[model samples]
Target: MKIAIFGPSRRVGVVVDNDVVDINGAYAKYVADTTDTARSTAAAALEVPADLNSFIEQGAGALAGAKAALAHLSANSITTGLDGERLVFALDSVRLHAPIDGKSRVFAALANFADHMQAAADNTASGSDKATLSRLVSGGPKYFIKDPRVVSADGDDLQFPRRTDLLDYEAEVAVVLGKRGKDIAADDFGSYIYGYTLVNDWSIRDNVSFGPDFQYSKNFDGSATVGPWIVVDEGLDPQDIDVEARVNGEVRQSGNTKSMIHSFAALGEYLSRDSTLFPGDLISGGTPKGTAVDSSIRDSEGGFEDDSAFLNPGDVVEISSRAIGSVTNTVTGTRTGKK
Candidate 1:
């Protein structure tokens, strides 16, 4: 089930045959029709809410119920809920939102990719410190918290910030947690994962000089571009996925999840050490190299001087994975006209 939370109403939906199914409404209708209860609609909403985050909180039963509801819709040709609520829609007919919004926390790993870490080491480290990035994973995955307020959805416009001229895009695979757990073992990560999604970890290249902190470079209110829909966890390997990024349709970054110095299991275990992992909380597992700054030093064809290297007004930045899906956000004009 590729589940999504979409549009102005923020309804939870399931993608089937390239169309969006209002799973919550369908589930409500299913519950109302199957059982003898006048308040079945209200009951269904409580049992299996229409919002993705709330729905996720219901855990496996709601997941199973929603799947059965979708199956019921298909089996019976159901088009609308009991109160005439829309139960199905064309994929492009409505807006797509980040699966979890305001309902969860986002912790993003830094330099999870060996190639990316190597690139960073090559640029900044000297002597024995250069290119020896194995120690990163040896110490386990490290992350930084991203302000959830900055999360923008697929097809949304990312407003270019006026503070820096070096806006960049990073393509990453984000793990969406399902069950809350503390000090979970690496082997149990599969049970706790709900699904996977894509995230463009937007950055301000020039702002790093002021950082030991990332707030100035990474959390500019529109930096977290996430989702098309979450590809539900159904026993798939999170450590073996593809990652790609394109700017204005030109492929700029490409790597696989297998290249991660730290695997999903390791990262999940690291995150749950003392804190609770909750449903809808995202673990943005860092990005692969070929970011603008990486290319500013590594690209063989002198790609650094290219105006298309960094985001500018009207550039569409797309982050993708074959297993999860893709998300594209167009970079629009400044938040203010300061620049």
Candidate 2:
């Protein structure tokens, strides 16, 4: 089942066919009708919460309740709830929010795909002995934590940073953890997996931060663009998702997670060793080859020395997959970063 937070109020919803069922409203009504009237509100909040993060934290009980709520709605033709809360809504009538609110940390894999690293190096490296993704991966998995403050949702306008002219995009699959686990064993990812969302790792190529971490280069107002919703990991093979990145209508990056240098289990084990991994904590698999700064595209189209062209003010960057769904966002706000 697909789970989402929708509309201006940010209520938790379940995607069924072409409509979104308000989970809280449906579950509350179920509680009131099935058990006791006094237990309705509290029961719905605890069993199938209004926040996606809270819902995940509730674990299997919440999952069962959410499914039961959907079943309850399907059994009847309910339109509105006891307090005039909407039971079901047209999908297009509401706005999609990030699967999790801005409370969870987003950990992203860096240089996990050899082709992506090759593209970055091919554009800038001039030395005879240049660094490669393979060389960078002789040790282990590398990752960077995104600033949760800048977590933008699908269809939201990207806040173009006012500091750099070279804006780039990295398309990836972000995994949402199901439960809290510290020092997760590499082979034990079967139970910890929860769901997946698409992420576009927007970067300002010119902004330099100390060391390899893109601390300053990545922490803009809209760098971590995620969601339409999260697809539960029931049928997906996390290590084998096919992802594609496009600018407007043109393909910029295309690769499968099978190309990843480090396995998902290994990355999970490493990430959890230092700190506890919780439900709703997003771990983004690294992007594939072909960013805006790709050398081949730059050489083919002679608009700039670095690449074809940096992200303009009105370009649409779309990151999509067959299983997880798509995230489409327009480059909006100021172009002061280009100035």
TM-score of each: 0.89, 0.91
Index of the highest-TM-score prediction: 2
Q: After superposition, how far is residue 224 of candidate 1 from its true place, in Å?
A: 0.6
Clashes of 2: 0
Output the worst ten-in-a-row residue range by lDDT, candidate 1. Answer: 298-307
lDDT tens per residue, model 2, 1-339? 788989878888889888998888888988887785687988798888888888888877877888887777678877787698778999988898888767788988877888876775665543421444346656888888888776888889886677876788889998889899999998897578888889988987663443765577878887898888988736888888999988988998889988998877888999999789888888888888887755432222223464445787788999999888899989876766343
Candidate 1 local distance difference test against the native: 0.80
Q: Output the TM-score of candidate 2.
A: 0.91
The regions of model 1 sitting more than 4 angstroms off are 123-138, 207-211, 298-308, 334-339
lDDT by residue (tens digit), candidate 1, 1-339: 788887689988888877898877888888887888888778778877888778887877777888888888888999998889788999999888888868598888877887887675564433433333445545667778778866899988888888877789999998888877899999988888888888888988663632367566888877888898888845667888889999889998999888887778888899899988888899888888888776654333322344346778878888887788888888988634223
Model 2, residue 206: distance off in Å is: 0.9
